[model samples]
Target: MKRSNCLIEVCEDFDCSSKRIKTSFIEGNNSSKMFRNTIWYRSLLDAEKSCLKEDKLKKIHYKFQDDKEMVEEYNVDTQVLLRRAWKVKGKLGGEGKWDVEIGDPMPDATPHIEGIGADFMESKDQPKLTRRNTRINLEWRIRNLPYPIETYSVSANNDERCIVIRTTNKKYFKRLQVPELDRLNLPIEQGNIQCSHSFNTLIIAYKKPQQLLDMDKEWYLELNRVKPIKDIPNDCKTQ
Candidate 1:
């Protein structure tokens, strides 16, 4: 999707750097169309159907499956560069029609199966957005860091913090363990994002509607969404 109010661009000249990360999403559904975590969940669903058909047992029993299983290869296209490179997304095919559609994720919509709804964070999945969030329709980020969106309202008078959100409210937000670190080149620390951004980019990603309105700060700033995510000169590490 075309990126505007890009976090990378706004923070670039500030000597901030950001790494491209491929984050996974798990969707579930009863239909043929896949949702995040469709693979394993689908398998379980099929197994459940099979067991029902073949069960000659008195009482049915099942094994407890971990919700955070990473047996599949799920990834989204990500294009990250110097914060000053707002055009970078366009140059690298990261640009496209994003916010124009009505189904795109917004304040209102059914949450993803993983529970990622009401969060303003955007993703790289096109068809998903066209289908899901728009009522509708849906990126990677640094390392394996789980980007918790923090929105704020700042203007001439009052500055307010509003929200703390991840794409969905699933295991991704709670449990971020992945064996595919080397495979996806995702960083190892889910909490070290602040320190990491000090070396690469600002490590901060902001959304559109730059206009500052009054918001809630306690919950919002708690996610570390502020002007100073990291100290200055973090981008020099890349140079």
Candidate 2:
């Protein structure tokens, strides 16, 4: 499969075209000069196309049978209603009144806790312990492919609202924080974090600004691509 990046502009916009993007890339990257770049994503137009089609939501109305005033009775936000209408978060509410199912009702505000990522020497009940499940518990993901993350610490402030993932390279240490939406898997607008161990990098991708309607086609201008991304770097100082 051919790998590439592109933008989708409204046809009315005279300055935008997929070919124009390719010509620019060819001029910049000598490595890709001879290869044919394929695949272009246009998100806006695709959304428009999808919206015009007949309702794709298959109305399975068994659960909402009991509630007569389903739509008027339920209290949900616009985003929540959209999710329910499409059955993305699971069929919620009742059968005919289809609602999106929610998990254990969490506090309206987000909750986050920090755990350690290192080794333990003696029988001390250290709060941070390393195990297979560490991957799931750890909030910060390290991506260091071309280089290595020597050591670091994670700090959260303002009731866990601000999170900083710091890494050291012996000579200097840099701190990268997790964005609010990324902390909870919430889509802000359109973006992704693509990790490739083979390439030794974790690519933080942003949606092509001009891509009008193709949501699937993204121009990942590698934000943070790293290799050998380990939970714990080899050189962690014992506390």
Candidate 3:
């Protein structure tokens, strides 16, 4: 999906002399849409110590001086990122349950199998998006799907700029957009879409265009030229 109102920015300048860092996001295009949270530390090493996910939460705790405040901040940031990255929400299947989707268990209940006597918690083998050398691939495991390979239909809808997957019996459906193609203003071609089913899993691949490949090459070359900063002290510790 194309998001015209939101943009993600990563700050590259980390100066220990400032003794602070910011994790911020901007909504809308103009100056009126800034959302920011600053984190201060005694030194760069102190800031670095909070780089880990767990440590970041602890740092948020210190910043807000309360657990509730920390939780609200974390939730807001998480939701924003998830909405931006995961344009497609959880899929529905088999009487309204997720067959191959991203989800969390109920708040008070454990993730247990329906007929496994509650001993086996559902495994988290969620659908994943991966990139091969020349293609973007999506893999979804729906172990309960008993349909034959002939029941599935996977097609690229150039008008919608998305790949659509559907079953003849209406047991499953998904609409997936290629972020790379959308960002580059490229059209989705029906000829680039491929699909296969194996071992109760559906795999779809979209061949990458030459423009994307060229962009990747240039990005790698630029990354190699970025030198690591060596002067930041490591002795300063965070409490």
Candidate 4:
């Protein structure tokens, strides 16, 4: 028995980025080749309609599984794509061939299995915010030095309020637990901290600040004397 397959390409641009196209396949049945062809062809038409309604296709390319070359290509503006697909359906079974009984209509195409439909729907419904890739940086401070702390590490809890800092001098490590101030006036973005370590200091930057609460004005004032530098000079190279 011969196997039949259809490759349909729908793209917004010639490069085919922004979304992916999925291929459909059906095996030929010796007893009901015509019926299967009608079903598969109708399904392709339905899919094309769905893609058009969502503006997913600017160009579509179709090819058969056995053919090494593409069978047809169409621009969405013209009706030739659908017409050609229909013609291909008729050709699958010989001309004037009627496999089903007289007065019996062709059955409606079977619905595509779950998750097997075109990926156009997933791309269309994706959230705009989730697609955005943005990074944020946060500056913090520590005050009232007990020792000349050199090497520092910082991490935050899931709440974004509780922060842990570790300062090291030689072989000694001192850990400090800090909680966010109750009344913060400064804007804070919540995200994971990215740490850059140098011989004498560690600069921590937050990646996603939108999730964080405002920084405390009182806390900022108290730690102003030992605040971490918000901006690093471009000339200053650190390991």
Candidate 5:
């Protein structure tokens, strides 16, 4: 199936006093559909009682349900909601309401935690991931190669659930995993991977699978419908 290659703009307005948060999503393409299929659960057992649409989640829930020890071990409240598309850390309120608070705000009045990305690195030699808003393919740039296009090779190792980058001369080698796909229980398919070299940088582009696209669409819609909190104290407002 063809994927819908569109970027979503997510805006979050949170109120710490009320422990409430509002998330909004604006799609680049106006034709995007909005869904209201929000499911809430206090724990694994609670989620198992509901109708979950995702197969991976279903399998996990079933496994836990069938095992008495596992059920007892995971029956406690976690203050987090796991859905087919995304996980929301908060308390489920009445009906569709949800109370979300990441943590205490910093002196600058911003939350301590932010979102995740493929580009985050701890060292300078690591491959840098670049997410393009105009395209659906994810790009990873490895600099300081100083090698021609034919000197490098990139391929997917599905058994390991990662993509391997290697130099023909054995000078450099790196294994990069797509954590986002792992959350969705997707495998690394060779057909969706491509690479090239430009200005001593080896760039690998992975086309997003259709399941991920649909997950994004669902996640965006749920966040867009969240109501914004009002009467936030001045200290809670960002500086």
Candidate 6:
């Protein structure tokens, strides 16, 4: 299957006062070479593993579901997600760290304490722990193959977002027609396809507001193709 390396950027905007947050995946430049060995991608994988571990711990603590059943389910799920990650090892990689920045940091303005005065005082004293408006930027590389995506999902955990992309070998590549793709101005015919071998990328930003975590919240996604300079058509080539 033909493949190309594309850049993906997810920017999260959080507004503390209004309790609003917007998450967007921005399609950036592309190259013929796949960046499997970049620092950003490695960090993303590490963060994803951490998130999954935390999730497992939470499930064990809550006991909302059967532990045996949950473990079996996650075991299968982890295999699917990590299949591609294991293949990117032993390659020359890029350098750079994934960044997280807080915008307009401040103390909690609310005076009243929900618990005892001692607890309230301790909480109020920790300014850094208070929620505030923030922006998080995550960058990674994705290889667009000739197969179309079959199923995918994105979820947020406090400050991290996990993205899962899955496609079946039986499917054929078609024009990308999703509204989220249109919003990012990426062409459907840009070789933006996916298959089971595609790697999952994770982005962790500032904490998402509770209001924005509703099931109805909107998300934007775009897949841009990466092509070799020699293979790109003249019209699509950068001057």
> In each prediction, how many residue pairs overlap at the backbone (N, C-alpha, C within less than 3 A)?
29, 30, 0, 4, 0, 0
Model 6 has an lDDT value of 0.23
> How large is the C-alpha RMSD of every model relative to the true structure?
27.6, 21.4, 18.7, 33.4, 20.8, 27.3
For each candidate in turn, the TM-score is 0.13, 0.17, 0.42, 0.20, 0.44, 0.15
Model 5 lDDT-worst window of ten: 68-77
Q: Comparing candidate 1 with candidate 5, which one achieves the higher lDDT?
A: 5
Q: 70-129 in candidate 4: lDDT tens per residue?
A: 112223343222111112234665532222111122333545456656553435222111
Q: What tens digits encode model 5's per-residue C-alpha lDDT throughout 7-80?
A: 22112222442334222223423223211222211123233321222222221111233332111101013211
Ranking by TM-score: 5, 3, 4, 2, 6, 1
Backbone clash total, candidate 2: 30
Model 1 accuracy (lDDT, Cα)? 0.23
Task: Give the per-residue lDDT of model 6 (tens digit) for 69-141.
Answer: 1110012222111111011122365422211121122224557666667553654322121111222211122
* Higher-lDDT candidate of 2 and 6: 2
Badly placed stretches (over 4 Å) of model 6 are 1-28, 31-37, 43-239
Worst 10 residues of 4 by lDDT: 126-135
Candidate 4: list runs displaced more than 4 Å. Answer: 1-135, 144-150, 159-161, 169-191, 194-204, 209-239
Error of 1 at 152 (Å): 16
Query: Clash pairs of candidate 6?
Result: none
Question: Which residue pairs show collisions in model 3?
Answer: none
lDDT of each: 0.23, 0.25, 0.41, 0.30, 0.46, 0.23
lDDT per residue as tens, model 1, 38-78? 34334433431101111221111122243211111111121
Collision count of model 6: 0
